[model samples]
Target: MSTEVAAEVVVAPPANDAEEGTKQSHKLERKWAFWFDTTKPKQGAAWGSTLKKAYTFDTVEEFWCLYDQIFKPSKLTGNADFHLFKAGVEPKWEDPECANGGKWTVSGSRKTNLDGMWLETLMALIGEQFDEADDICGVVVSARQRGDKLSLWTRNATNEAVQMSIGRKWKEIIDVTDKISYSFHDDAKKDKSSRGRYSV
Candidate 1:
């Protein structure tokens, strides 16, 4: 039920007017699913068990509309997470698209532009701004105490060329010169990612 319209952005405060229907609507490359998890998860429970699929939006207007209402990461007083992944790709390591995947994590101070960087990352993702767009699985923004983390998930872990290209492109999109590191899910399972990480 998703529309495949060429992406054109014209974001503004959501208006409740009939004229809104007559205005041109901007479309994203594909639908994206917004997910969230609470700070206090049940002990010894399944991963992603608390995740709530807030909404799946395909249009720019829909994205802004939902973002205005429920996408409030800054309001969190405790640890939480906000995930924006491509439609159908749940933000998990076991999904078929993510089984052999990895993530490029950029850790920064909470005092920095966490929200701004996160928004930019979402825009770049839905806008298909990366050369290896298909390689992207999704993005996760973790609101932590020490520092906030922005991790761009990828579909392939062994492809160094592809992973490096994505890492560089993502850093460029976020306008950051600092090096970011990529860690594969498989390596993390073995608790050896510290030595296996690839930096760009």
Candidate 2:
């Protein structure tokens, strides 16, 4: 995942900042990286530099540190993306790990369950809630001017069994009311059925 740039940006944990009686904690299976992509013309330079280290945490404390520092989806301008992936995997569509995989995309207005779904999906990914985590590459969220989108990428789109299970687990994790569609890179490229060969 060539963390050269990622290594430099660090998000530190909060101090004993929690109220004495109300502390909460979480543990994740693997360490993950949080990336903020700003795709605006004016924020180019600043965004580039701002791609600074967010934080890496296996425990809940560090995750909170990074999450707390970032702007919520509602506050982000259109064209911004937030990516969370297991350490060592870059969040690029072309990565060897992601070349064949496609994302199960969920789209909706913010007034819907967009934010809740995004957060739960992230929690599922980082918390290892999927049986096919071995095939999962990472997750990306786009806050577009049109609508917000969240995607979960797998290692290979051709693995129908794994792909279908992953898709089902994703939908289950987010527990959304609307239909969620799974698309393979190949199918998506052809502009055809983003439908999964199988559904979870």
Task: List the lowest-lDDT window of 10 residues for candidate 2.
Answer: 1-10
- The residue-by-residue lDDT of candidate 1 on 37-127, one tens digit each, is 7546689988878776667778887887766665655644447787899999999887899999999998754466777778889889888
**Top-lDDT structure, candidate number:** 1
The clash count of every prediction, one per candidate, is: 0, 2
Candidate 2's displacement at residue 192, Å, is: 10
Instruction: Name the runs in model 1 displaced over 4 angstroms.
Output: 1-19, 192-196
lDDT of 2 at 81: 72
Please give the RMSD to the true structure for each candidate, in Å. 6.6, 5.7
Q: Which regions of candidate 2 deviate over 4 angstroms?
A: 1-27, 41-53, 187-200
Q: Total clashes, candidate 1?
A: 0
C-alpha local distance difference test of each model: 0.77, 0.69
Which candidate wins on TM-score? 1
